[model samples]
Target chain A: MKIDKQKFPDTDGFFGEYGGKFVPETLMYALEELEDTYSKLKDSEDFKKEFYADLSDFVGRPSPLYYADRLTKHYKSGKIWLKREDLNHTGAHKINNTVGQILLAKYMGKKRIIAETGAGQHGVATATVAARLGLECHIYMGAEDVKRQSLNVYRIKLLGAHVHAVDSGTATLKDALNEALRDWVTNVDDTYYIIGSVTGPHPYPMIVRDFNSVVGFELIDQSKALFGRMPDAIIACVGGGSNAMGAFYPFIDKKETRLIGVEAGGNGVSTGEHAAPLNDGSPGVLHGARSYLMQDEVGQVKDTKSVSAGLDYPGVGPEHSWLKDIGRAEYVAINDQEALDAFHTVTKLEGIMPALETAHAFAYLDHLPKDFDESTNIIVNVSGRGDKDINTVAEIDGIKF
Target chain B: MNRLRKKLDHLISIKEKALVAYLVAGDPDLDSTLDLMHLFVKSGVDIIEVGVPFTDPIAEGPIIQKAHDRALKNNISLPNIIKLVEDFRKVDDSTPIILMGYLNTFSFHKELIDKSDQHGVDAVLVVDIPGELSISSYGISNPNIDSISLISPTTSQERIEKIAKNGSGFIYYVTLRGVTGSSNLDVEEINSNIKKIRSYSDIPTLAGFGIKSNEDARLLSEYSDGIIVGSSIVDMITKQSESRNFDRIGEYLRGLKNAIL
Candidate 1:
């Protein structure tokens, strides 16, 4: 399972047949420029030095891999370790990518930064970096997201970034993405688009994944330093698969280690309301790449539902799709009830409030066998904090938060 | 020769600029789209473009996106769009027709590319697929159907030469560095780029994107061989739903045609 990075995504930015630049001709120049710049700078020692410096001082990288003692006892099977990405400056792993892209934008002399956010995590992250760099910033959010995640909208506004409410199809993350793409295509000259996840056309998926891979590399060293060995399995929630890819890429060549991606099974997969593209969708093109998408036969994107706005996307990252197709990774789904139960249980037992998206990963442990080898170790990526979802969870419980 | 090439050649022989009008199939409804096609011919449109509606059209602006939404609401698909062209062909056999859309619609059925002649489509312009990822190798280059390529303002000169060498029918030169339906046309830049592309190959180059006015069309036609008016025409068709009179669309087409010719 030795991953040959050099052989992937040949000159055209394809990972197998899944990823390509399917964007319009107007934005072709920007994508090509990004590709060339990333290729030149990705391996430079100076760039890495600067990136890691900010990751340490600004976004607080090398987040702890703490052992969840209570969760281990509850599961009664395997020892569980948590990769605490939630402790980052923005309370999510999204800062890892935004910080990298902002640096790239500054290096490219771009004066403006734009992004799309569903749960406001990416928007806050991008706005923070843009403010840090003193650049003009704009964020597109679906109107529905704006209503449900108003605190995030206020945070973005407080950071001096303009939040544009998109009232398009379904009024959600996909619509926000569509609007952000329009803005990028129209203002391609001065603006840098910082995609929030490992999705989109060529260069973006690769770029985001590269920026987030620090999580996996850190986890490898931290685990060996603490426990003297790599974990038996790694789990992360896959909403566009950025955080999961970040935590999984370094260990992909280690066949003995299991990479499990958990997706939202809202209601259930058979109910056709879930956002689990890897589980229920087919291969199609969406948002600029050919990936697994929830679409009708004639190729129109379908609406998706999930308790976590971050996971309510109809498509997944093309790299994840390629990985699933090749059997390099295993994907599973956790329903809303199970995830909510895990959210409450973990918060009470471990004294940590988990985001709904991250809860899906924790909930999967309940489904695993009640016993494992004594030496088995499992790592679960806690991608974000639960502060943003307090109102949502309270409303579901019929409490006035 | 394909009907598009023949029509362009005939227009060039007479020293006239070609006026291409674009309409979304099944917008408002299919019957009105048919009426608009015939009306385009009557208004002196040299060629007709039938845009197959898609859910995610990243390259299009508000006007075309709304048109696509309406078309989808009415259940427009590739087969139905081809049928609309077949119905249009029943009356007018001379005007060249092009099916314009994202690649997913055309790639959905391999036979759709093979049956272009039977469906009376002269050219296929898959907006998302660039020259390097040509579908011609996949049998889209059926002798009767010419596969089109696009050149944007940002396209490098070396890349233009390569795309032009492989392109057939016509090379669509995006007049602005923006999406369809966007404003701010720089006719001087368009003229210069078209001249540069013309130097690379013998294929005809047509200016499109943001050619909204008679002045815009007239100014752009002075540089390129023809002009393809999309958003402006589709915007007019969208207004027809309110006015319920399709004549204004023809009148606007005649105005654009008159300005160019």
Candidate 2:
């Protein structure tokens, strides 16, 4: 089945059977307005020039695709290359989407910007862009995440954005998302919701994916320039599937490069505590989009536990669901312990302290197919830095300070 | 005809405003909810909107969200709520019952929704799948069960026409620009939007969201066919959950009902 990667989310915003405008009537107009305006601006030369210039100058774009010599030797199978999205401004690929969205907010003449965050990387990125653009920004994060990722919270606050600590329903990513949606519903007229991932209703998943696809497009150029060919496989972590979708979108039609999305496996999938929705959950409507969600028999979203806050969500992006259903991409999970080990190993081997979310992708190196040899070239997306996760790692290591 | 349509027509013929009372089923327990349903009809509630508790009620405010959380914590399921409606029908069959909830709960239990009419449910108001996307879109094609749709202050004229045309039973006109339980009733806005909705279709438009106080009910009922009070009533149920004495809730319901009449 040759799927047209470009002709997705057909007008009504459905990626196959997933992704639709499953929101309240109040938000329908706002989404339609956004859709209309985005359609006009997305292809305009002015929009492209402004967006690319900002990406190059502000975000330090074209983040190097460095060959991981030590890690490749350690793996003794695939030649590992790292797409260093971690090197971008604000220390994550989150800035890439935020920059693009805040630009859209500016063009739309929205006075306020609201977003939901899990790891606080996206929160920090949104705050950074909102500050630069001089827009009123509010970021909703789970109360639990506020404590775990305190550094990023402080960074968001320092960047002049208000942080709302949502204490409802496990007080994590999904709950934060619910709170953010409520805020959007209330302030739909003057506010622009900068959804941090490729999830949510209609144009949001499409918009976020398009903005972040720069990562994959750049990888295509860098791989050809350095390795003389496309990668054998591309791996990235999926939490609402922003970075992975960004890295995989450009290669969906390129069948030679295998796309793999690593989900957080908390204890394990069998424990019913992990956040790997595509791997373990069923198809259901959640957070305004029909996607794979970790829900129970009665359709109540189940609680998900993960060491990484970013990957601790019960849902993934809808496009990933479509990709998985079509067998265009492979979905897998990495347990917390394995991710932690990879965090330490990657830091020691490559001197690159990967975020726990990013570490999940690196951890999959050990599980690569035995057929992969030195001739196989694999690129893993370092989606974010670990500076925000230092405290979490320290507590797990029993180092209180 | 569905009970909801028949009741709405009867109310309109008599020039009496409809009072739609909303409560979370199984908040205290399903038995209490059944009792409350009886009590609401006794207090002149023309219709009953039973909230089917979901894990995430995004369109709800803190009051109703908490009510949903409480009901869910009590281990309430769609089947349990459907059974509650069945039990309610054993005593009272005149007051139309509408299952109000997010789409996931109803979509997940298509079998239950398929037989909801026989079980005494007249309509379903799914918060997520609004407009042209009805309960039938989920494959639960029960012609006897009406799919209620919402029209808000932010809804455009074009959308109002589409939503009002697609909807059945009643057009829920959200009184405010916010979620359920949000404050500030724009009477003029409500009048205009409801009039706009009525222009599109003859379906009865009921004003809801932030409809507290008899004055709000009186003012909103002047424009629309009826008023739907949710958060304030849910708040009352939460306060009186311990004693299970719903006298104040009944009094409040009667107060709004009299104001509308």
Candidate 3:
């Protein structure tokens, strides 16, 4: 019974099973003129005082929710908690869905933005929010990811932007998302595009999972002020599942935490090798909707061997396909020589080097659930920064040059 | 007052004669791709396209690139072909999906082609960027999202008015130089290059590569405005995977989409 974006309003977000205006009727009057200028700039108190003074003086939210206390004394009873989002501002969590889609592309006046990357971390976070809101950027990677992320393609060309490279197909990141959807269907009137993940279509997976639900609404206000408690388990690493549904949709009505996710099981999931798409995928209907993929028997979309070019993608995330068909998220699998043996065991035990898509949540820390030994805490969501995978992890551990 | 008169304003109040089908999404898997897109939109198929499956389609041939390498040996990406056109727009939200792949799988995903205009997808052809170049050779905007473009038979007439003022859905015209499923159906030079792209724009100009029967979609839908077939329905699913008699090739593509509508 999905149809409920305020009862099929039909601005762009449909709601049948549930909805999908599926975008591009030449930006259907620029997304119905930015949903009528975000419903009259939500009672414009000067656009919420310049959107919370640029969300607390330009992109620095309430970040840290730390306490890994050395990976939680070997899960003695489980109290891990890390949610750093690799300390935001372009290092990861793709700049909280690129500062709310570049302030809805500067309230739809749209003076050019267009994105698409693979490991140039969301085209250097949409070229650092189109260079602090002045706008005019470009991106689109995959001439083999601008020659394997040449320093995030020179940090999206030192934040001025205009990158290109593409060379089409297997050049990578799904051909820089088909050349930023053929440059937003050939410049859908000015340009803004942005989509880096949480897969695509439908109000961009609910606006990049509501701008990465400010990382699970500040991990439920810092886990109810440090252990008055909630997360008995949450974990992350889903790729295209927008930092695992922005750290699992504000604790999805907290049903005793324990959620998980992981995926990417490349070289495992029985030698079909892995990008574990919702635990060895099946559901079908790729790219637009209907989830769980890693295809074959004829429904195409297969090449996913995940050395984690952002979890390589075959498919996953229609709300993680409605949280794995309503079990409230559990899906697993973590292969590719166990995410390169948890990326060389979390860079020689915690110096960090994480992002091989957070090495599939540290290769499923010995298959979760051990129950209340040290007061069960767990959170995970680390999200990025293995410094663009140090030359494919020093040439897959053989280490040279 | 133009863009194909507002894309046939919900098809000129059902005037008729506009069938168009074309396939290729995960080939034979995504649950026979949601039962061959619900028997190609209940066999009326007023526009479906889909395809996607690429590896190196380069103007395709060899049985639609072996049904696109059996749907990319089952990894069919372009966001799993726009999540199968946003799950067939939750059971057909007024037909019209379109997508046709390559151009580096929709340029990787340009925010899933501006979120495939909310997934009911009205158009996007690609097959090696052919015309107006979608906003000067790839910049994409989305005035409801249509980009079609494929002018061959060795395109000219001064590159069909610069690929018909940079194409925007309603001009594919290839008629055979070779590839897609070439057996060759040049039909008097495809009705003389669709009467020379209907002398530049009034838009609607279809015609795909090596079409194949119901007299090649009634001899290229009586000189264009329809006919895109695709390696004869991927050579009837490679003769239903070499005759295990797969549901009699969905009753031979419901007898070629009811003998080309």
DockQ of 1: 0.70
Evaluated on chain B only, what is the TM-score of candidate 3?
Answer: 0.31
Give the Å error, residue A98, model 3: 22
Residue by residue across A233-312, what tens digits does model 2's lDDT show? 99999999999999999999999999999999999988988999999999999989999999999999999999999999
Report the poorest 10 consecutive residues by lDDT, candidate 2 chain B. Answer: B129-138
Ranking, TM-score, top scorer first: 2, 1, 3
Better model by lDDT: candidate 1 vs candidate 3: 1
lDDT string for model 1 (A130-209, tens) is 99999999999999989878888999999999999988788899999999999998889999999999999898998999
Summarize candidate 1's per-residue lDDT along B1-261 as a digit string, tens digits: 778999999999999999999989998899999988999999999999989998888788989999999999999998888888889889988899998988777777668767878888998888887664566754465778888889898887778888888888889998887778888987677888888888888988999998888999899999988999999888878887866588887888889988987
Output DockQ, candidate 3: 0.02
For all candidates, state DockQ relative to the true structure.
Answer: 0.70, 0.87, 0.02
- Each prediction's whole-model lDDT (CA): 0.89, 0.93, 0.69
Error of 1 at A93 (Å): 0.4
lDDT of 3 by residue, A27-71 (tens): 333444555665676457876576556655665766778787666
